[model samples]
Target: MFVESVVRWGAWSILLQFGLGVSAGFCPPRCACRPDTMEVNCSGKHLTSVPESLPSDMKRLDLSQNKLKTLGRRQFLGLTQLQEMDLSDNVISMIEVEAFQGLQNLRILCIKNNRLKIIPVGVFSGLFSLQFLDLSENEILVFLDYTFRDMGNLQLLEAGENDLVFISQRAFTGLQNLQELNLDRSNLTSIPTEALSQLQSLTRLRLLRLTISSLPNNVFRRLHRLRSLLISHWPSLDTLASNSLIGLNLTSLVISRSNLSAVPYSALRHLVYLRYLDLSYNPITSIQGNLLGDLLRLQELHLVGGNLLRIEPGAFRGLTYFRVLNVSSNQLTTLEEGAFHSVGNLQVLRLDGNPLACDCRLLWVVRRRFRLNFDGRQPTCLSPDMVREREFQGFSEKELPRVFICRPSRIIDRRRQEANIEEGTNILFSCKADGDPAPTITWISSQKTLLSPTGRIRVLSDGTLEVRYAQVQDSGMYQCTAGNAAGNDTLSVSLQVKGFPRNRTMPFFTEQGWIESSFPPTANSSAQVANPYPFDAKTLIIATTMGFLSFLSSVAICFVFMFFWSQSKGQIKHTATIDFVPRASMGGGGEGGDTGRFTMKLI
Candidate 1:
């Protein structure tokens, strides 16, 4: 009996040791034992669904890229100790209500890229400790009110890239602990301000690709804690009011592809601690002089593809700590002499895709910069005919040949040189003449009066004269006489006053003492003749006598012919009979009759 008792006690001790080993995850491969640790890595097993009968003590379960279609009731009932689960890239279609009933300790759940169409009420009923939930890239078309009511501890939510068109106002009522939310690339036109006002703990939000035209100025007033924002591809947003981002702690902001025309300096005044600003892919033309004055702590600024034409002289006068400045892909033609004077600590400068004009002024600046040459050749000059075709690589300040030779002064009339001018207006006389000591313009009026009024006619350093507005009194012969150390030349112009005709009722010559009978006198007339036009007295008398003589001569020739014909009618008839009969009888008789008639006529 003693030996039998000893053997039984040894067997009982061995059984107790085996039980403890299995509970600590030292069990054999074929055993169905629970492990003490929370990690359950079931990767690369080609499993279609969450393995059944998992340890109740597991805190994390990763069933990624699987073929899990649905999660019915009691599917996760055994995982009461689970805290996080990753089911991304899976075939999850439907999740039954209360499917996670036993997972009261779950905190993080990621079921992104699934086929979830609807999230029924109480789907997460028992996950009271859920904190982070990501359902992004799903086909979720509908979600019930209070769908996440049981998840009071939810801290972060991501529902972007889904077909959700409407969100109930109270859908997130119980998620008071939520902080970060992403609804990017969703079909949201406008977000109810109240819906987002309830998220007191939300400190960050991303709403990329939401075709929102404009946001109410007070849209972000309730989000006092929001610090980071990203808004892209909103083509209709052109202007942002100054108070649009009021009452928010925005630190980092990105707004791209917005087709903006100009940056409102007031829009960024409230962002005191902003560090990163991106204004790329906009149609911005110029930056205001005081644009970056208030952004003292700005670190990175991107102005790519913004169609910038000119940067004002003091544009960035106050941004002393700007570390990275990107002004690439712009239409910048000229950079003012001291454009970037105040940017002392600017570390990186990107001037690529900018058609820089490498003139004498800009040549030295580009040569001193570290990376000005984007390609092998230096930027080409777009100014001054001499160095226009020259590149920056082969040219240097010392090598740039002698001073521009001033051509001899050539006078040009201001009236004729100007292509188009109004009819009645008087133009200021001026000429551009290149000479050794520069040119001096003097105006000489038609009455030989010199216009020497210092204030009225002032000359600029470049020799452009701004003649004060001229009047009809000022219209007369004006000359622009330019002289230098060399010889001088004068350009003359006659300025005529333009007005309507004097008399509208009578002929213009009548008012000038012209009359119809007032004719020029000949040598015989005693009255003196001043002018003669169309007809003078002597010419008129000569023309009348010649016309009368021609008429009398024509009448006399016709009268003589008629008188002779009347007086010789019978003789004419006898001669005609003799001439006709004799001619028919004999040729000699016809000849003798013809000769007698000829002799009578001659006599």
Candidate 2:
């Protein structure tokens, strides 16, 4: 009986030890744990504190979508094997300094979608192996200096979509190997140029929703290796400094949905290797001349939903390898063929959603419509009552002559304009014309100088000629010439400055007509005419000059008489004869043109 009891006890002891081993490896309550894979998923649990009894050997922990409000120090003390932790979408507002301490193997930490107003330093301490850190979608207002100083191996940081206004210059100090940083959709007043330059290995940056008006010079000189940059939704952005992007070797750049009124030609002249550019939803009214000649390797260009009126010839002169162009949803009536002649390598052309006139100006596009891909939305006619709403490619070549007709540019108000203006006053000449393709108005000055948009004489935006502080030299027939591909028209505007200067200070009209003065008038000097005095201004000048000459001759005679009397007193026999030689005898000139000689013989 004693042997039987001892054996039974030994069997029970073995079974109890086996049960204890299985209990140690059991899954936590209300949690799914794959002990084989070492991952714990406790997401969406309503418990306020961190889930208890998490597997000790788990490599990934997801505690997101919980009501946890604060993270206490040493909360995750034993999670040494954790390689990734997701604490996003929680009401976490405060984080003790040592909350994530000893997470040396954590490679990814995401604290997004939280109510974090500030992330004090030392929160990310001892995370030596972390590669990606996401602090986006939070209420963080500022990033203190050295906030991420301990995360030396961090490679990517996404802190966009936050209420960030100011960031310390050393906020990203130790992130030397960081390659990508995104601060898009934030309320940053300006680009944190100094703060971002510390990332020595940064290659991509995104900054959107800025409120700056102009980019100062050399803003990106320190970000030397940046390859792609995206800047959008800056409605107040207008002027981009010419040297703003001087040091970057960017391959792609985007500046969209802004208030830019024209192509920043001078600003983009140095982006020689830039291949992709996007300038969509801007207020750019036109693209004129060879403005984009410097972008040699450009492959794609975008200018969608803009206010484009016309694209002048040679606009794409040097984009030899250009492949795609998108200028949809604009106000262009027609595109002159020369606009795309230099872009022969174009494969995809998007010119739809525009008010096309279906005129001869767009025949070149219709001829090549079959060869070029329109990207689903083809060009549609908006004019020529018969062809309105008609597809561009539907029209046959035989039907083009009647539908695609052009009208020669003509001066609607064809009459010579004559005006008399006073000096020191501003004057404007109005010229009106019409044509199939809008005509360009040019004004030629009386001095045969082309009137530009600046200087004393200039052309206004409405094609009116403005002369500021008019002078007498500006008083002549000014020509207003309007020309286009169809034809040309011209009219003369006769401007007479100070026509009746002695009468009044302001120019006035007369009953007969604009009386042309045969010559510049002088003060009345005729004796027959009733005058204030016979010696008027001009008459007095001549009389005074003649009297002064006679006085000079009398003084000479007195000198000659005095010299002879002195010689007689000395009993000197002085016989002096002065003879003058003509300049003709000495040829055209002598030394310094001073050959007028006289000789006096004294005996």
Which candidate's TM-score is highest? 2
lDDT of each: 0.67, 0.83
Instruction: Show the lowest summed lDDT stretch of 10 residues, model 1.
Output: 500-509
Candidate 1: stretches off by over 4 Å:
1-38, 42-49, 142-144, 360-603
| Tens-place lDDT digits, model 1, residues 73-177 | 867886777898888888889888888888888889999998998999988888888888999999987556788888778888998999877777777778788
The candidate maximizing lDDT is 2
Instruction: Estimate the Cα RMSD of every predicted model relative to the unseen true structure.
Output: 20.4, 18.9
